[model samples]
Target: MSSIDSQTTYLKYREYSDLLKVILYSSQSVLGAVPLIYHLKHNNQNIIFIQTGTMGGNVIHYLISNGPPSKKFIELKRLTGDYTFVDKIGTDGMSLYIPILELEKSNLDFP
Candidate 1:
């Protein structure tokens, strides 16, 4: 693994269980998926990882994830309301939405 990978992989994940609320991955980054899964899992931080894009969820689940977060979630209920293609969005506001199939399967320890 590269130095960057090694660094993130070794961080304390349990501490981030409820703190790390967002993870927005772009298709451009090569080591964006499993490496993150390995890092998060290795540290014991079970997360409701919001995956987006065409191949984003596929990439992560294939690598470090034991399985996806559960599928029994309602889309925050309120977040489902209609909005323009580009509305209430900011640099850190939006994230890739994970499918219900993936979310419903994992036994995550979310807060």
Candidate 2:
């Protein structure tokens, strides 16, 4: 691995459980997704996702991480309802929409 990749993984995912915290709280912000992208860009491991109390009060299962960067995702951006694209947005202000499938799936952790 390159030194940059090593540094990114070391800092972003030092604790496996912290991924949960970051997803649940900060997924919509640069702080959360940047580290997540860094980690995914460098690592092949996937994160387990567990959900309880669904439509029928059942449990659902999925994996919540990716292998590497895809070209489409690299060019993706969040946009407002008015179609204003943004890279970084505030946590509690106007919502920024991300349309990429993987990122939308990652947002399911926000609970």
List runs of model 1 lying over 4 Å from the truth. 1-42, 53-71, 78-111
List the candidates' TM-scores in order: 0.21, 0.21
Model 2, position 57: C-alpha lDDT score: 41
Span of ten consecutive residues with least summed lDDT in model 1: 76-85
Range of the 10 consecutive residues with the lowest summed lDDT in candidate 2: 34-43
Candidate 2 residue pairs that clash: none
| 1-111: candidate 2 lDDT, tens digit per residue | 543333221122333244334333444554445222322211335443333232434332333455422332222223322332244433534443332233323322211
- Where does candidate 1 clash, by residue pair? 51-96, 69-103, 70-103, 70-104, 71-103, 71-104
Error of 2 at 40 (Å): 9.1
* Candidate 2 ranges beyond 4 A from true positions: 10-21, 27-97, 101-111
lDDT of 2 at 40: 20
Can you write out model 1's per-residue Cα lDDT over 1-111, one digit (the tens) per residue?
543333222122332222122232232257554122222342453433432234222212222335334333222112322222222223423342222223324432222
